[model samples]
Target chain A: MKDALLREIGKVVIPFIQIFGIYIILNGHLSPGGGFSGGTILGVSLIMHKLIEEPYKSRIKISERAVMQFTCVSLILYGLLKGYSFITGGGEFELLDIPLGIPGRILSGGMLLPLNVAVGIIVCFTIYTFYTLFDKGEI
Target chain B: MAAAANFPLLIILILFLSSFMMPVLKRVKAVKWLSLSSILLCVVLSVLTLAYVQQNGAFLYKVGHFEAPWGNELKIGYLEAIMSIMFTSIAALITWASFFSADYEIKEKNIMLYYTLCGMLLASLLGILYSNDIFNCFVFIELSSIAACGIVVVKDKKENIKAGVKYLILSSLGSGLVLMGIAFLYSITGNLNIGFIHQELVKVKDLYHNTLIISLGLFTVGLGVKSAMFPVHIWLPDAHTYAPSSSSALLSSLVLKAYILLYIKIIYRVFGIEIVKTLPILEIVLVMGAVGMIFGSILALLQKDLKRMIAYSSVAQIGYIFFGIGLGNILGLMAAIFHIISHALTKSALFLIAGNIIERIHSKEISRLKGIGIEMPITLGVFVVCALSMVGIPLFAGFNSKWNFALAIIDSNRILFIAVLVASSLLNALYYLPIIINAYFGEENTKDRVYMSKEKSLGALLPILILAFAIIYLGISSNGIIDLIAKSVSNL
Candidate 1:
């Protein structure tokens, strides 16, 4: 809110927060932290950035429509991906099998990586939108 | 033919996936068309599924790759197939009707959200109907509750929001109790699948008597509240009255029926009827249901608001369903299922008619509806048919259900409760007949009204007329449906 100290600290902190969020999303199948928690962390960083930079004219712009479209697209992709898996698995068809990679790798979990990424995008946008809507009543 | 087996799962997926597309689409008309067309597709799929079931018998479909004990499953039977058809078709009709009237009731921007909620709600309701696992049912129950509450508050009025909060809080409590019940069942049986749990429960029948009773009570009261059973139906009137008319129709006709269906599955599949009959729970249910029949109608008689009155009638009709279940006989349960069909048709038509009248007259007060028939002749004529059905007039759907209920009572050697049925019908008449009389006959009421002046277009009235025709058709040929229900009950 026009505070120089907080803005300086935020600039230093936000990048690390975002990188850690991405790491968790990438390693979701191999670790405890996954899409939801990682996405929440990223969302908090966004909220902090918005709070500190909202008073400045040069802040990064994120339109409400873009956030909504991103959320909806991610949700649709998530549904389609999961629905494909369910149909193929339930019907016992071996169609489009992405070979499972080494167990500890980021790509090891067939569809889990893509699903996690989609969920992460959705949760991130959703949380940021919630913040904006509550903060200003129009998101 | 093999692919037809997957229609149940496809119906759920189509609804959920298509609903997410609503907000992303720019055109409202496209969103509405998409919503209607998806529901129509489900209707066709459901009818195909039912036909497949009729030919092949009930089958269980595994969700994803997991087997029965480990993963989710959908048990599609005669009951489920029929229910899916009913839910999808009725929802399609309601969405079509609301297409004409939603702009008047809901804000332009919020209309897309309304369709989204309806889609989600129908999907979740179908989920509840098809789920073979107790925990799966619980998840669907929670989803349906939230979607139901969302549709209620989507009207964006202060009263709607207040009613929505009331409904949400009470419904959450209902869900919490259901979760606890599932926990109790899971702990004792070590399985979530209904068939597996039944096997385990039958083996250990005598070991955990008290726990069994507690879990049974929890399920009964929890689902009872969700379905608007007698004592716990307080939130229903406000929520239904304040919601948009299509939402009200869906709530009264479809949503409440799903929970009751789930309850029926629990009683029959999880805990067999022989085991349940030994407990005092069925007797309590029977008494409560009988009381609800009388009190719900009595309450309906006191409501001045037309929607509130119709909402209370739902409570009374639900009592009849529970009463049928409580009879704990084959015929009784069959009657309950049949009543579900009849009530779904009759009540949806009634609510949509109410919407038509409200749209044209800009009023919801029953007093203001006097001589409305003189203006909206066809709408009131449909209403008269629906009211007669509610009053159990011979050759209407309600009469057949009451007849079956009486036979079930006699079959169970509970002939005294037949009086409750008669009294409840009289009470139904007390509330419904006066409006019909004032609408059609009174001189002062009819003097100023122009015939056909307030009638909706033929396209708008077509759904209600079809529903009315279905009601009469059901009444005339209920034997076939009753036989089908009997087979389903035997399958249970």
Candidate 2:
């Protein structure tokens, strides 16, 4: 965990992993990789950063409470969004429809994109918390 | 009026959404109130939905934009409406009761998580009850299983963890079998909707006889385990015994009943009676139910722990339900449905009473509860009502269910099983009567007890008392309920 070479490699590799995860999450509707897989990839990067960096000296710090708050907010937002859709769609109300962009575009798929982002955030925090809790029995 | 149709979906959404909110809130009191009020709203919505159903009729609501075959659907009927009302009201009462006692039994930090799990469990149970699609019900089944296990393990004790793991494993296996059954049904019928499957099966009945039978067997045994049916109820006593009192009440009263309702749906809705009668499964179910009635009571008689004894009594009561189902007649199924409601009321009250005793005395051994009536007069009095109901004393809810079973048996020409019912009631008395006797009477038991010293607060006892009142109310005026159940069964 304290190896110099591994830390150097992780510093170089972690940014790419996060960027790719974001890309997958953003393009989930048009591509195979979605919230779960992409968020997992991001989570692995986080775990790696925690593993490689010195505990006290790490520039980026996420507290357990912060993680819980983020997860809860994302989940509530997701539920509300889905509930809205279900109500509008089931009741056949043509109210506040999110315009669907072109089918292949990154920003397409109306509500699906936001839902994927919410799910990604939730999964990312959940996985990170799981890792931290298992690794040190605290967070 | 039209908006009432959306109550079913709204109830589920509110429960799930509020459950997620519990962890973020800093105040534990806020979390508890949020859980209680949300469930109360659901109970009101359910009653409205029931009224709507009574005025109109059963209607299928589309989950989203798509229609029945493609999208998820919720079927609300007389049965579903009544069941939702029962589930929500009982859950509301249990949550209300837990408000006072949860702090004592569970760790302070874990109390929020306990409410969260209860909310999730209720939502998922409602999901199982209302879903019209088989795959949707399967998803709910998995959710309920996890939530159920979570509630059991939330006590955070060694025995709780062990019992929870055992329950988790068995419940997962039950869900897995259900998934396999769904796969079998889907592969053959090419549909996940219950109505469509029934239609497809009617068309292909002769062609896929063995496949139908296999799928049927899978459903029965799978749901049997989840509902603590005769042979597969091994995990129940431990999990119920170790869980917090409110959790035990919810598990015993509501969770198992939802699974049994799902089983009933699978049998009557997915596979129509015409197709099911061709198989020998009903006779097998009858035999198992009869055996469970005797053996479950016998096992209960042997347990020293009070909660464990009541948990075994659940097994026996479930036997009566399955017996009604196994009778393969309309009246029998009616009895099963009625018993579901009666048992839900009686058993939850019993468990809450058990919880009250444990909270007051800090003990679970039946022997330690000597002369408890002298200390906790009202609590033990309520217990006497529930016990007499369990023993099938006339004019009690339990007696009506047993009476229905007897009539159903005689109607089905299974007069021999009537003796089994009588024997099972005797066995029930054998276990329940002794505790009542020891709690209230005898010189040694009452010598050192103080009057009303161990009674729970009125707020805490209020729910159990209401449940007791409902039992007596139902006992005296069951004709209306029986008629309603008959209507629902006829609709089925």
Candidate 3:
């Protein structure tokens, strides 16, 4: 039955999926995974929630209103950093981090870890943003 | 501060995290104000980067201070600076306008997600702009494509979703080809920095002729797809047609141009002018550009849908940039860069105005645009000014750039090219000028201004006006912009 498919795709199973997403995000700088991969995983988990749960309840999980505001803020943060860099003369498009850690280690590279984390957030919220719109039958 | 030297990447990370937080903040009544403050702070920061670009010519920074021969590097230069300014300046303005529109278009539900994607889009764009190495560029490219896909598909309507799928597949193929080319270049040159690779290429040019040629061909193909060159333009019309207006502005204006900028870097900087001048490669690119100019414009003229027509027009305009590069003269190259700025101004301005019209009329078909101009005069006026610019009428951004392009072509003394330019400009008029005439002189519906939002839409309108005015301003004071472009292109 479709219900069984939904049951298997529930939060219990989805949490593990979300965790996997987290790992990919955190370890993005080291291996092939990065913000995009991790973020996509989070998006997939949200989809899992959609399959198993009632649409309305899951609506609150990733509110469309929130993604709008978040996407705006995320961009502004990039602007703010560059603006600050410009003011202080670090040069625009400058890279960051110690890369003190081993090449393959987590937290080892400069801003790659941070970059991955940012991408992960974007991926998850964007995916959820899509789901919210779709399930609302607004799409 | 050096303490925050990692600021470039941090910006994206913070934005990514904020996407997660944005949905939560929507619960708070004050969230709108909060978002405003944050974005303004960021915009101010983005504006600050121009000073840095002016001060530092260009350099690559290794993430974590890891030397680039071993680890990846973030390339910061004049080109990157220009791209950042373009991306952030327009992005901030649009997002600001979106803030006001969010009050209307977005329901109580979807506003935060919209903001999140906006940030993702910015970060991905910045990532693309800042990445020094080709592989790193690929990552950002994918990030941009994915985020863009999200924004376009956010509507989730069948048309929008279908557009997103097309965008994704075409973008992926483009990226795949670019990656393969990067691999090939790395194998021969053993380096990726444009200048450094130039050195390596010379040392090994004799031994690796086939590989070099193949890789160059691949890079051309890859970047061509992204640039939406004549043969590789299948995805652009749909992607541009289907996305929301702000999203369309970003896609048509910034995203496609960014890829083209990469092509400039790949051809001029990576391979060096010596090769471009000596080899027949410039001819290949030039020929493609000439065809794009004539072909894209002709296609644009036939479209009934305003957005689809505009999309096709972009395909044509991109050719102008390539034409400048193809001419391979200082004036020609300068003209190309100048045209890039002009087209960005004209195109994004038009798209924004189109957004206003779409909001009011609830349609993008050219036929439905009848008499709608009466109610939305300002929006229509902006569209007219921009269309004139596209047609390269005198005293607009398009005119100055076209003049430079003409001079460049004449200097090259290729009579066929002159014909191509003349023919294409006429073709450009064919598509764009008619739209303006139709809007102004067409049949009128009842003049009703119900639900018109121009006063509140000033945030969006101001940029269009500034750009349109600049078109005229740049046309009159063409020397300044031309000098800047000359300096920049010559440096490249």
Candidate 4:
């Protein structure tokens, strides 16, 4: 993978892909792009990195354990947040008591913002971890 | 009572959350204890829930604050209570048993993942039992199938991977068909809730007759494949045989039963039995059951591998349950549900004992097992007790269920099946009895006595003994269980 042309193009392209993915995820509540699609975009950026680097070591230093912990913490946080609402028997607004901010804004969807981020993290980590597992046996 | 009714929701939440917690408990013992205690708590909660349901009548526990028609609901009744208790207890026992031997059976790093999968499997099965919505049921079915596949391949053997992949492809195809079937039902009835769908179907019965027929056909094929019904059972023998022994016990005893329960609930609860009575599907099920019973046992007789033999025997046993369903009588349904309990206990014990033997000798072939029973008398004796039950010997659990099946069909024109049932038992004895004899008597002249072990661990021995005693106790107390099953059937 020492092809200079492809690596140069990838170096230029990956950052833009990631920034757009984050933008889509952050604006998910107000627009069509959301957790799943945006998370997939971010995951593909990692895949692109894996392609450009032969061993995928220097630039990306995340271990399987770190990915696993990130995924687990994000999902459990989601579960606990939902469980809290469930046990308290509160509607979204009543639970947080936060204003649903102007309708088309980033904060309008009450709890959807955090949930979308959690889900995006899960989707992203799961894809990258699956690649690691298939590439080697661990993770 | 109100708090008790929410037990179903609590059971799912606890098990699902514990599965995620397993990776945190990196120590094998910590993970094992966490899984065991959670499942034990689930069993107690299910018992309390069963008592509450039995006394207060069936109730719906809505998820979140939404009303039943608009949101997810857990419907608890006598049948669900009995099934939840059955599923949890068997899981607890199997987990406890495997705790001791899992160190030997699985790689060191994967043991935690194994417990995690077990937890997920339990949650999904319980979800299947408790769900009142068709789409929710579909979601749980998919979850359980993936967890089931994980348990199989977690053993890290080449054969296990092959079996796991084959199981994944076929079961997914089955689930895809099930999704299509659910879509058809939803499109026609405009409802995701089973109760609402049934109510709408009843009103529009005449207009959507053809579409309803197609939906029913799709449900049968879809669930039939998932449950390992006759013709589509090719994946089962390999997957069950190649999985770790405790996994074999769980998959064979409990996982398949969950799908059948959902199928029955869909047929009797959602469609209404009267409408089902008019359809030709029950008769087809009857024919398939009879053929499967004979074919599966005959195939078992041909396998030299102990696990494969037991795996084949499972197909025959499953046939009995389907045949009972096909009988279309109150007594017949009672037999089916009763047999589910009996077979779950008996088969799990058999596989656990088989694991004991396999662990001792390091060979799965039955011929190689001659004389090892002398070294491990208690394990082999448990095997004998379970085998007798499987043979339908009187006073064993299998005998009573088979007797009821006989009695149910005796007055009906399907009396020929009575003969089939009898012949099937004889066929069962032909394959199973020889193994017992070979184990106890055929080892005198063998040179490989070195593989025989003199002692069995308490962990493994305790579960086998408990399940063995449950089998015998269930057999002797068959009258009480019969009455209970009859009451549940009446409720249905």
Candidate 5:
């Protein structure tokens, strides 16, 4: 049970897991996973980081205030867009003049790509922030 | 070519896509921008479709290119467009208002799920509004139930979790019963399309359509439970009270109406008035609606919790909807739809303000909320306006609809229902008026030194302010919205 060169396997495995997390995040709109599913995978990666890289190193990973800021701002921005729709006579989800790209490309599907990316960022950061806050029993 | 009227499908896709994306965007923080954009995009699409539908009148959309006479089809008519207008706009408001009210410990704990449910609820509501196929409507109803349940649970609090579980169980049983009804209807016509079934129902006036009638009865109970109709409305108070603030606003505003709309469609379209004019079951609808109207107000009067009372109040307001539908006049139906918007605006205003009060006072009990009007005068003022709307005070939108609803009842020889409506609105005033009194007029509690956050309530307070003003605006300039609804109803 003495730990030897086997620790190197954990080292190699962490990066592999993170790569897979990124894959899930980027390919979310096209395939099965996206912001939510991928963000969670990456968030789980943070726990692994804390386990192996020492607890103190995790302090710099995210700040609670930033997460709060992100959560509020995202909600506000959503409100503004919806408010605009109510005031206007157009579509509910108002789009820019961007043309709907061909359906097959990664960049296609109108706003879904950007929307997914936004969700991914919110999810990942919020999860990491929650872990940091909760780990210390800090509200 | 009529298959091209499937514009609502794109709206659903947008919501689903955005909801799915919300989880992982922490690094970029761009998801915030994108989510709003998606909603805005939906508004645009709906308006475009509105124009298209108006110019071309009603068109049936056979989904997956299936021809209408045999396979299922989605009906995109004027009635559908007006309903879409109601739901999408209300959804936009709730989504917008969510920005300011919530920022808490479990920031990302279930944020993605929250947005997903919101989107799903919106999509399903729109689907229910537009879909001409009974089975497809059933499918959307199931989606709405699951989404609303998910919204309740998104907070993951013990109370919220329990509430969500109860709703899930009840709603699932309701869905099963609803699906059974759809199956029965399908058996009769050998087709699932509403228009097709409408034609078949007109043809065969002979014997034993009793199964179809029984199926309608089953569908009534199923949808009634979802509507929190009086006797079976056990889960409503707990589920709505425990859900996060935004979700509660949505449940009050749009969720119940979608099912009620189904009841309207079924009675008018599936069975048609040819048989309905003979059956005394229209009396049953009027009776149930009247009971809910009075019972909801009485229950609301006894509740200590702000959200619970609001939930009870919703039960009563739903009674008004069924009342109008049961009145069975174009004017009554128009009034019902108009009341849907008025109630949506007013209830959301009340709830959003309640969220702020909860945030400030950290309690929902009216007794604990002594002299809150002095502390948060602006919010109290907003609530007053919303209350005025709810009670059908002269200048708010509620008066116009209530007046029309009463008129409809009179026109249909159900003049006694008018007494019920008047008594219910008064009873509503009794329950809600006291909260306003306690908040605005009550003497200050001498003991607890609450350090009120002046800045803390801005998020929840502002949007409600806007809606309270909308109640007035719509009341005075209600001609346009009224015209739209009237046109939609007459088309039906």
Candidate 6:
């Protein structure tokens, strides 16, 4: 875990992993890959950094407070949007009156894309928090 | 504030929204009050919904504005409204009771999580009660199971964690079975909606008889485990006993009832009454219920821990509900429904009072409660009232339920069930009466122990007092409840 070679390799590989995850999240409705899959990748990248680097050497550490806040905010946003759609008697596909942009594009899914972003944030933050809680009995 | 049609979904929304916000709230006191007020609002909304349902008859609200047969829907009927009202009221009371005792029972850091779990658990139960789609019900079942486990483990004791893990494992298995059954039904009927599935199944009843029977069996075992039906009740005692007392009260009083109600809905709504009659599941349920009635009482009688004894007694009480359902008659179903309310009030009061007693005296053993009545007269007084009700004494809530159950089964050929009922009540008395007798009449108490505290905390005492009053009120107004449930059952 304290190997310099592994840490260097993780640093090189993490950016690609994050970019790929972001791609999957943004293009979720266009393809089969969605929020959960993308979020796992992002979460695994952060976990990888924790595993490879020495505790004091990691430059990009996510605080538990930040993770908790992010998870709560994202989930609350999702719930609110879902609740709005439900109360307005519209489908999940229609959060507001926004047009379903051009098909096969990154922004084509309307509420689904934002919802996917929220879900991805929740998944990523929850995964990170879950690891912290499991490793150290606090989060 | 909106149309009556929106209330069911609104209840679910309010619960989930508030629960999701609990972690963000810094002050545990604020979280507690927020949960209580929201749940109290749910109770008011549920009551209004009950009246709305009575006036408007059963109605379905399609979520996402989708068509009913294809999309998720919330079905509000007389039965669903009755269940919602029961759930919200009981939940409100439990949360209220927890406000006082939580400081003593739950650690400070975990208090917010505790309330959050309770809120999520109630929300999921409400979701289960109103959801018309089988898949939706399964999802809610999973959510509730997790919340239930969270509440158990929140105590942070080794045994609580063990019990929560055991509950999680067994409940997941139950959920797996339920999901499998839902899959089978969906495969055959191509619909997850209960009403649509019923229609499709009836049309092709003969074509898929074997698969249908298998699905029914899966449902029976699955729900049986979740509700802790007799043989599959291995997880109930420890899980219920080790949980924080308020959680235990909610678990024993309301959580199990929701599963049983869902089972009844599946049998009566999806399979139809005639099909269930043709199947042998009810007979199996009847026999298992009778055995559980006796077995659970025996187990209760053997328990050293008072909470564990009450926990075991729940199995026997659940048996009464199942036994009534197995009677397959309107009168029997009505009796079961009435018992749901009576048992909810009585058991919750008992658990709350038991929590108070343990907190006051630092004792969990039944033998140590000698002359406890002398110190905590009002608490023990409520305990006595609820205990007599549990024992089926005349002029009490349990008596009305037992009386109707007896009348329901008297004309039927299941004479053995009547014998089982009598035996169980006698068994109830055997275990319950001793505790009361020892608390009052036994001379094990010294003078110092007799004058500990005459006054109970307002928070701990109020819910118990209200529940005790509700028990007596229900007992005195038994006829009105019987008629209401009779109409509800007839409507079903």
**Top-lDDT structure, candidate number:** 2
Report the poorest 10 consecutive residues by lDDT, candidate 3 chain B.
Answer: B447-456
Where is the poorest 10-residue window by lDDT in model 6 chain B? B443-452
lDDT of 6 by residue, B1-492 (tens): 227778899899999989888888888889999999999999999989888887888888888767887678988888888889889998999999999888998899889989988999999999999998999999999999999999999999999999999999999999999999999999999999999999998998888888888898899899999999999999999998899999999999999999999998898898998888878888888778888889999999999999999999999999898888888887788888888889998999888988888888788999888888888888999999999999998878999999989988985666667888999999999999988888777455634654547547666688898898888888887776676676677766
lDDT of 3 by residue, B1-492 (tens): 333334455555455555445555636345555444445555555445545545655555655324566556666555555656666666666665555555444445555556666666677767766766777777878887888787787665788889899989988899899999999988887887655778888787778877877887888888888779888999999988877777788778778877877777777777777765656778898999999999999899889998889989999999989888888888887788788788887888877777777776678888887655555677777788888888888878788888888898889888678888889888888877766666556434434534243332566577777777867787778885565566566567
Candidate 4 runs further than 4 Å off: A3-16, A53-59, A86-108, A130-139, B442-452
For residues B1-492, could you state the per-residue lDDT of candidate 5 as single tens digits? Answer: 232355666676567556655654563235545665777788877877788887898766544323666555567677777777667777777777776654541256566556656876887888787778888888899889998998888887899889999999998888888888888877777778888887876776455467756877888888988888777788888988988788888888889888888888888788886677666666677788889889988999999898899999998888888777777677888888888888888888788778777876788888887777667778878888888888888888988888888888878877777888889889878976877787655345423433343425565556777788889998888898888777776666
Model 1 has an lDDT value of 0.92
Q: What DockQ results for candidate 6? A: 0.50
Best by DockQ: 2
DockQ of predicted candidate 2: 0.75
TM-score of each: 0.98, 0.98, 0.78, 0.94, 0.76, 0.96
Q: What's model 4's TM-score?
A: 0.94
lDDT of 1 by residue, B1-492 (tens): 788888898899999999989988999999999999999999999999999999999999988988889988899999998889999999999999999989999999899999999999999999999999999999999999999999999999999999999999999999999999989989999999999999999988799888889998999999988999999999999999999999999999999999999999999999999888877898888888999999999999999999999999999999999999999999899889999999999999999998899899999999999999889999999999999999999889988998889999999998899999999999999999999999999789899788898888999998999999999998888888887788788898
> What's the best-to-worst order under lDDT?
2, 1, 6, 4, 5, 3
List lDDT for all candidates, in order. Answer: 0.92, 0.93, 0.72, 0.86, 0.74, 0.87
| Candidate 3, CAPRI quality class derived from DockQ | incorrect
What's the i-RMS of each model? 0.9, 0.9, 8.2, 3.2, 10.8, 2.4
Which 10-residue window in model 4 chain A sums to the lowest lDDT? A89-98
TM-score of chain A of 6: 0.90
Per-residue lDDT of model 4, residues B153-208, tens digit only: 99999999999999999899888888998898888889999999899888887787
- Model 1: colliding residue pairs: none
- The C-alpha stretches of model 2 lying farther than 4 A from their native spots are A54-57
- Per-residue error at A49 for model 3, in Å? 13
Which runs in model 6 stand beyond 4 Å of their true positions?
Answer: A90-99, A102-108, A133-139, B443-454
